[model samples]
Target: MSNSIATWMGKGHAAVEAPIGDDGFCFGSEPSLADVCLIPQLYAARRFEVPLDACPRILRVEELAGRHEVFGSAHPSVQPDAE
Candidate 1:
């Protein structure tokens, strides 16, 4: 599972390289479906302890997303159902 998640995130990291631009989110200036999907995958990767040292773009995305209220508040650590 860890290897799979790492590979998937690596692909995602490559995909966002050119398109992410200065705004940070995957499509245009605001968060889109791509960002929405990417955020959760990142959470899953972290939860599973998948190393992300090589996926700088993904790490950047995760960092920026972590600052958004809508996204930040939904993190597993802060969620009401989290254990």
Candidate 2:
């Protein structure tokens, strides 16, 4: 499980490292559908204790998304019915 998480996150890290954009997001300055999808997976990764020390780009995207008004409000933990 740990190896699988590392492999996937490594792939994600490489994708984000490309010349996608100057902004610290999965694609560009603005959050897109990719960001929407990636954020939850990142949340799950953290929940599962997946080490992210090497995935700086993924972490950066997660951080940027966290500050976005839409993403911030939509986070699962912030939902009205959340435990």
Model 1 local distance difference test score:
0.74
Tens digits of lDDT, candidate 1, 1-83:
56887777667666666566655776665777888888887777677777678666667777878888999887778888889
Q: Backbone clashes in each candidate structure, one number apiece?
A: 0, 0
Residue 55 of candidate 2: its Cα lDDT? Answer: 65
Candidate 2 structure quality by residue, lDDT tens digits, 1-83: 58787677767656655644555687767888888888888777777677778666777888898888999999999999988
- Worst 10-residue lDDT window for candidate 1 reads 14-23
TM-score of each: 0.71, 0.74
The per-model lDDT (C-alpha) reads: 0.74, 0.76
